[model samples]
Target: MKIKKEFPSIKVNKEDQTIDVKSESNVGKKESKGKVGSEDMQNYFEQLNEIKKRVVHLQKIVRRFLKHVHVTEFRWKSVIGINDAALTGIICGSAWAIKGSCIALLDQNLKLKIRPEIEVIPSFFHAESKTNLTCILSFRMGHAMGAAIRLLTYWRGSKRTLVNKPQPLESKS
Candidate 1:
């Protein structure tokens, strides 16, 4: 008995341990139609209008939600430590808190104000007897908090607005 090999568009030889390969040169070329028709253009514009309508609806919903929702309290904290020698180090911690409310207007603008309270604590290992605590009321934390809240609110609102809507049925004539 002899072993035989075969493949589509290929020739294999087991006796001589050789294979023949073939490629079509016209495989890269495709026939092109003349031009886009008026119906195709009409369909494209209709789809665009539908998308615009959905976007407007989403914006209205977001604006309404923003107008009613308010942030009553916010807080953030961070700590850092450094060691200059094997037995000694310095440690520091800071925190900020803000309380406020905001309202979003019909023109997609926001009105907001916040009062922030900040605290800082520091300690040095070399000076074991010395530890300090400081407190202050400032406007900087208010700005930072406002920006953060706006960013988070818009992100969450956009996520909530993304719902799958049913596509219109097409008449297959």
Candidate 2:
């Protein structure tokens, strides 16, 4: 006898700004473990509005946490292709070309790449290895106090954010 099992997976597509969650569950069985209750659902914008509010709150916490974060070292080395030298050369060249912009973007968001304490190093090796990657990233210990303070302060602020804006009525054509 063989047992049949399934796994769950979640994929995020940044370009499309969408998330795909896939899972196989025995919800229809006599005893279901992952049943969604009716009370957890809303008819329309209520759910989406609540989700939006949560996203905003989470973003605030992340930004506060990031403010406390500092990168001390970032190093990545990759070598592509073994049998085909042309492919390896092209990939290596492309990686080198994009390295500057990648670092610039990193610095723009983190604001630590250019600091004297940070060591940013990226390299492309054309040695024998179909695909190989070596990366080392070291960041200073981020204090959770800032994020905690921001969370508490947000709750103490005005209730304007909690007031759900009225959803625009849809036109019936």
Candidate 3:
């Protein structure tokens, strides 16, 4: 049986070798030909608003954490040193490897195409005496993690919506 690419709502049962089609009129009573119903559009807008609210809430939490956290001490070693170089190399290598593995797994399992671009910017705080030191390590780490979580959430949400979208009904005579 030939499946029409234009009609994505039709599903073919491979086991029984049968095609199931639903009528488009049954989807929404007010919907006109080639046009979505007002109710459906409103529902879509509502969902988008909900998503935006959730994202804003998440941002507020992150901001609160950043504002309240206090870091007591921070030490930055020279990368020219053998130990520092080794440690940096290990950390950077491990992070890239994990990202690569995750991309590979996602591609293999979900057929997702993802290209990851990572950039690290280094910032330094210098004080005259060792006693006067204020570090923002926790804040920086929290911000990074929060951003990563937000990105993952958005990706997953979009993918889920795309994959689980309701199929439109096939027109009936």
How do the residues 1-173 of candidate 3 rate in per-residue lDDT, one tens digit apiece? Answer: 21112222444557655455432333333322232444545666777656555454555554554454443333222211123545555555554566567545433433222233333222222211111111222235655676657645654344434322433433211
Candidate 1, residue 103: Cα displacement in angstroms equals 14
How many clashes in each candidate? 0, 0, 2
Pairs of colliding residues, candidate 2? none
Per-candidate TM-scores read 0.21, 0.39, 0.21
- Pairs of colliding residues, candidate 1: none
Order of candidates by lDDT, top first? 2, 3, 1
lDDT of 2: 0.47
Tens digits of per-residue lDDT for model 2, 1-173: 22222334445557655444444435432221231222223423575665446454767676667665565545545444434556666766776667666667667556464332222222234344322222323434435666655655655335535454433221111
- Residue-level lDDT of model 1, residues 56-157, one tens digit each, is 344554454455444333232333233433323223321122111211231133323343222333333333322222222223445546544554554533
Regions more than 4 Å wrong, model 1: 1-60, 81-114, 118-173
TM-score top scorer: 2
Give candidates' CA RMSD values in order.
26.8, 13.3, 23.4
**Residue 56 lDDT in candidate 2:** 44
Error of 1 at 132 (Å): 20
TM-score of 1: 0.21
